[model samples]
Target: MAETTLYDRGMATRRSVLGDAHVDNASAKMTEFDADFQQFITEGAWGSVWSRPGLTKRERSMITLALLAALGHDEEVAMHVRATANTGATPDDIKEALLHVAVYAGVPAANRAFKIAREELAKREGNGQ
Candidate 1:
């Protein structure tokens, strides 16, 4: 068997957290224009950082949610919220993170994130995810 590379490990971690369908859809839409950016996130974000053993994926997921919320990355926040099903971060975990975001990043940023998170949670609950 081939020795696993960073890209391979990243892909596995990405699929585990984000789900195969999302990964496959994103891969299917890949073109030369954004290929390097996609590879960078996989190798750096998923492989280098997320695959590290220091933090549970749940912790990482909450942290990601908080940062994304703080930065007002609404779509990314929603995506990550949906990913919590696999990461073991519950809705309460998301709430706590966003509450932290409110305290640190400001209420407006976290307020918008709360709306997005609630919508995503409802959708996830409906889907039984």
Candidate 2:
């Protein structure tokens, strides 16, 4: 497929997984300066890797949560935590992933991640989401 074609597919997948509100917000924030970067992520990260069929979306969600936590990407981690609902990742799944993070990514990171996840999960629960 052409690069633009692939990017369009990627953007669609990205919006479906991350939600249109979040994707629209991010798109609104993109300036001329960061446009390339945004496109890169849409085309590369979402299109190239995330679109692969090797893993279920649920598995991908778990891996994404663990990696984001390990990298201290709290905001992204929180976003993905919210995405758990769409991806069929349960609180139990998140708990198990966080336990893995605690072992490999360190207790501090896991602790902070757990707090963020709890908050997001509670908010979702409150909204009946």
Best by TM-score: 1
Candidate 1 overall lDDT versus native: 0.96
Rate residue 70 of model 1 by lDDT: 92
- Lowest-lDDT window of 10 residues in candidate 2? 1-10
How well is each residue in 20-100 modelled by candidate 1, as lDDT tens digits? Answer: 999999999999999999999999999999999989999999999999999999989999999999999999999999999
Please write out the lDDT profile of model 2 over residues 54-113, one tens digit for every residue.
898899999999999999999999999998887888999999999999999899999999
Model 2 sits at a Cα RMSD from the real structure of 1.8
TM-scores, in order shown? 0.97, 0.94
lDDT of each: 0.96, 0.93
Worst 10 residues of 1 by lDDT: 120-129
In terms of lDDT, which candidate is strongest?
Answer: 1
